[model samples]
Target: MTVTERRATTRAAPGPRPAQPPRAVAVGVPRLLYVLALAGLALLTLPVLALLVRADWPGVPAAITSPEALSALGLSLRTALAATALCLLLGVPLAVVLARTPTRAADVVRALVTLPLVLPPTVGGIALLYLLGRRGLVGEQLDLLFGIRIPFTTTAVVIAQAFVALPFLVIALEGALRSAGDRYEVVAATLGAGRWTVLRRITLPLAAPGLVSGTVLCFARALGEFGATALFAGNSAGVTRTMPLAIYTAFNGAGVTQDSAVALSLLLVVVAVVILVLARAWKPGGRG
Candidate 1:
C-alpha cells in the first residue's frame, strides 16, 4: 500500500494517544457507617466478654472434667456428630433439588425445609414429639408393627439436633450450588459424564466451601441444642442429657453448681470458636 493510504488507515482505526488521569487508590469510609459497624460488632462480642468475666475460672477444669460433665460432653459430641452426618446425607440431595429445579413446587419445598429454622426450638420439639411419640400417627404404627419407640431415647436427641441443623446445611449448600450455576455440569454431561460423575467431580467440588461451612454450622447448632432436645429426648444423663441439658440441670440446682454451668457454657463457646477457625483455615484442593 502507498504510505499516504497506510497513514489514513492508521488514523481511521482508533488510536490510544490520549493521556488518562490516574485512579485514586484510597477509599474513605463514612464515619457513621464505621460507627454502626463497630456497634454491631460490639453487640455480638460484649456478651462473650461478660460470660468470660462472670465464669469461675479456678473451677473450670473440675466442672468440665467431672464424671457427669464428661458424660454430658461425650453425649453431646456423639449426638452432634451423628446429626452432622445425617444433615450431609440428606441435606445435600435436598439442596441439589432446591437449587437445580426451577419449578414453583421447589420453592414450596425449600420453604418447608426451612420451616424448622424460623420455628421456636420448643415448638420444633413439640412437633417432633407429636410426630414420633408413642401415640403419634407414625409412632403408633411403628409400635404396633415393630414395638419400636423413638421418643426420649438417645436416638431422639440425634433426631432433634438433625431437625434443627439440617436447614443450615441445606440453605448454605443450596445457595452455593445456585450461585456456582450448572454450565460446567452441562458441559461435562455433553462430554459423556453421567449425572453422578458431574455432581461428584464438578458441582460438589465447586460448592465445597459452602458444604464445609454448613457442616460446621450443623455441628455447632447440634452441640448447642437445648429446648428441642429437652422436650423430645428428655434429659437422661449419659443417655440423652447433652452438655446443654447438663448446663441447664446445673443452673436449675438439680445437679451441679452454677459454676459448672458457666464452665460448660464457656467450653461450648470455645468449641464453636475452634470450629470456625478451623473452617476458615481449610483449603479445598489446597487452593480455596
Candidate 2:
C-alpha cells in the first residue's frame, strides 16, 4: 500500500457531524395563539388595573378605616375562613371516597358533589333560604326547638360561602387522590396497617400538595363570594355585610362615586393576589 494510503487507513474515522439546529416551524398558527392568549390575559387584568388607576390615594386610608368598611372586612374574613375550614373538614373525605370507590353510585355522588360549581350563586342563596330561612323547611323546626333561625345572619354567610367553595376543595382533593397511586396504601396494608392508619400515614401525606392547593383555592373563592352572601345573609354591618356587599353599597350610595368603588375593588384585588402569591410560595417546589 502507498504510504499516504497506509497513513489514511491508520487514522480514526472523523466523528459524526454536529446535528443541525432545528428550523422554525410555520409562524401563523403559533403567533395567532400567542396573541390570543396575551389578549385574554390582558382582558382579565384590565379591571384590576383600572381599579388601581382610579383609586384616590388620599381617600383610601379613610375609606378602609371607616367603621362600616372595617366591619364588613372583618365579617368577610371571619365567614370566609370559617367556610374554608368546613370545606376542608368535609371535602377531604368526600374526595377520598370519590377517588377510591368503584360503585355505580360513585359517579352520581361525584356529580352531586360538584353541582354547586355550576349552580348560580343566587340560586344557591334561594335554595339555602328555602331550607334554612325562617318558616322554611328545617328553619321552622330549629326555631321551635332551639330558637335558632339560620338566614339573614353571619351563619348564613358562612353556609353560603361553604356551599360555593366546597366544590373547589372536593375537585382539587379528588384529583390529588386519583393522581396519588394506591401502591402506598397497599404497602401499608401489607405491613399490617389498618385502613384509617394507611390513609392517615401514607395517603394524606402524599396528597398534601393537592390538599393545600385546594384549601387555598377554596379560601380565595370564599373570600370573594358575593351573590349568595348578599341574597341569603343580607347586608348588616358587623353581622352579614362583607367587603363585596360594602363595595355594592358604596357603588349605590349617593355622593359616592365609581372611583371610590374602584379603590375598594383594588384593595380586594391586592388581598387576593397576596394570598395567591403566599399559597404558591408555600409549596415545596412552587405551584404547578
Candidate 3:
C-alpha cells in the first residue's frame, strides 16, 4: 500500500472506541433482576441474622455447657465427621463414574444416587429403616449371619447422616469433573500414564476445590440432620441424640427449656459459619 493511502486510512479510522455501558448499568442491568437478586440474598441471610439477634446470649454458656448439650455436640461432630469421611470415600468414585460414563445405566445410577436429595428426610429414614432395620431385608441377613443390628445406634446415626450427605458430595464433584472434561486424562494416557496414576496425580488434584467444597457441605448437612436420624438412630442421649435432636428435645421433648434449644441452634450456626470460612480460605495445591 502507498504511504499516502495508509496515512489517509489511519486518519479516517474511528477516533475513539464507542463508550461501553456506564458502571451503574454494568452493575445493575435488568433492574428487576437486580432487585430480585438482592431479595434472594436477603431471604437466605436474614434468618441467620435473626437467629443471631434473638439468641439467648446470657444463657448460651450454661445451656451449651450442660451435660446433655455437651454430649449431643460431641456426638454430632463425631458422626458428621464420620459421615463426611464416608462421603469422600464413596462419593468421589461415584462422581467419577457419573462424570466419565454417559450410558443409560449411568443415568439410572445418577438418578438413584441423587434420590435422597429430593426425597423427604423422613421418607429416606423409612427407606433406610427398611433396608437396615433389625427385621429389614439386608438387616435380617446381617442379624442372622453376624448378629449386627443397625438401627437405634451411633452406627445408625452415621448411616443416616451419610445417606443424606452423600448426594451433595457426588453432585459437586461430578460437576467439577464434567467441567474439567476428559481431555487432560486422555492426554495423560497418551503420554503413557496408567489409569490410577493419572487419576491420583491429575484428575483428583484438578477436582480438589470441588472435593473440598462438597466435603464441607456434606459435613454441614450431616451435622444438621434431624428426621432420618430421629427415625433410624433414635434420640437416645449420648448414644444417638445429635445436636439437632438435642435442640428438638429442648424445644418439645419433655424436661428441657427454649433457652437450651436457642443456645444449641446458635452453636450449630456458628459451627456452620466456621466451616464455610475455612472452606473459602482453603487453597488447592497450596501449603495449608
Candidate 4:
C-alpha cells in the first residue's frame, strides 16, 4: 500500500507549466493599424509643413499688412464668428430634442440636420442660391415684400458658412447630451426646479466642454471655408472675399506671390492647432 502507491500518486499530480510567449501575429493587427495611422498623419501633416516651408517669412508681414489681406482676414473672422453664433443658437436646441425625443420624426430630423456635413459645400452653396436668390422660391417674395436680396453679400457669406458648419455643433452637442446622466435633472426637479431652470443651471454647465469644443471646431471650419463662400457670396475683394478666397486669388494670379498664399494657409494651420490644443485641455462635468 505503501511507497510505490505514494510515488505514483505524487507523479500523477500536475507539474509547474512552462510560460508561453505571446504570438507575433496576435500583435500584428494593432501594429499595422499604428503604422497606417502614422502614415495617414504624415500625409495630412506634410502639406501644411510644405506650405509653411514655401512661405516667405519676410513677405508674410508685408502681405498680411496689405489692405486686401487685412480686409479678407477681418471679414473672415467676423463672418466665421457670426456663423458660429448662429450655429450655437440653433444647434443646442436641436441637440436636446434629438437626445431626448423618442419619436421617429426626431431621428429623421437629426439625420436632416447632419445632411450638410456630408453634402459638398459647393452643392450647399448652389442650394442656398436656389432658396434665397433674387428669383428664388421665397427669395422673390422677400425681394418684392422687403427688398432683401441675400446673395453676394457678407450676410450670404455667413449663411453659407453656417450651413456648412452647423452640423459640427449639432453632432458635438448631441453627443454631450446623450453622454450626460439625467440624474442631476431628476434631482433638480425633486428640489422643485423647473425644466428651464434645470437645463440652464445644470444641463448647460455639464455640457460646456463639448459646446466649447464644437464652437471652436465650427469657427475653424467656417474660417477655412472656401467653396460655399466663394460661390454664394462671389469672391469680390473687400466685400465677399475672405482669407481662403484671398489665398486662392493669390495662387491664381501671376503678379500675386505664392508666398502670400502659403502664409495665409500657415495661419489657418496654426489656428487649427491652437483650437485643437485648447479642446484637448477642456474638461466638462458630463464626460464621466
Model 2 lDDT, full chain set: 0.87
Number of the top TM-score candidate: 1
Q: Model 2: runs farther than 4 Å from truth?
A: 1-29, 285-288
Per-residue lDDT tens digits of candidate 4, residues 1-288?
Answer: 799999999999999999999777743466788889999999998887787777788788888778888898899989999999999999899888888886999989988998988888899988989989998897889999999989999999999999999989988887887788688988999999999999899988888877887888899899989888888899998889999999899888764477777777777677778877877776665352
List, residue by residue over 30-143, the lDDT tens digit for candidate 3.
878888999999999998888778777878899889998889999999999999999899999999999999999999999999999999999989999999998898999999
lDDT of 4 at 191: 95
Task: Evaluate all candidate structures by whole-model CA lDDT and list the values in order.
Answer: 0.92, 0.87, 0.92, 0.86
Collision pairs in model 1: none
Where does model 1 exceed 4 Å of error?
1-18, 25-27, 254-256
Provide the lowest-lDDT 10-residue window in model 1: 252-261
Off by over 4 Å in 3: 1-27, 253-256
Top-down TM-score ranking: 1, 2, 3, 4
Query: Which 10 residues in a row give candidate 3 its minimum summed lDDT?
Result: 22-31
lDDT of 1 at 103: 100
- Candidate 4 residues lying further than 4 Å off, grouped into runs, are 1-29, 284-288
Candidate 2 local lDDT, 151-265, one digit each (tens):
8889999999999999999999889989997998998899899998998988988888899889999999999999998889998878898999889988996555555666678
Quality of model 3 by C-alpha lDDT? 0.92
Clashes of each: 0, 0, 0, 0
Pairs of residues at least 3 apart in sequence or in different chains that clash in candidate 2 = none
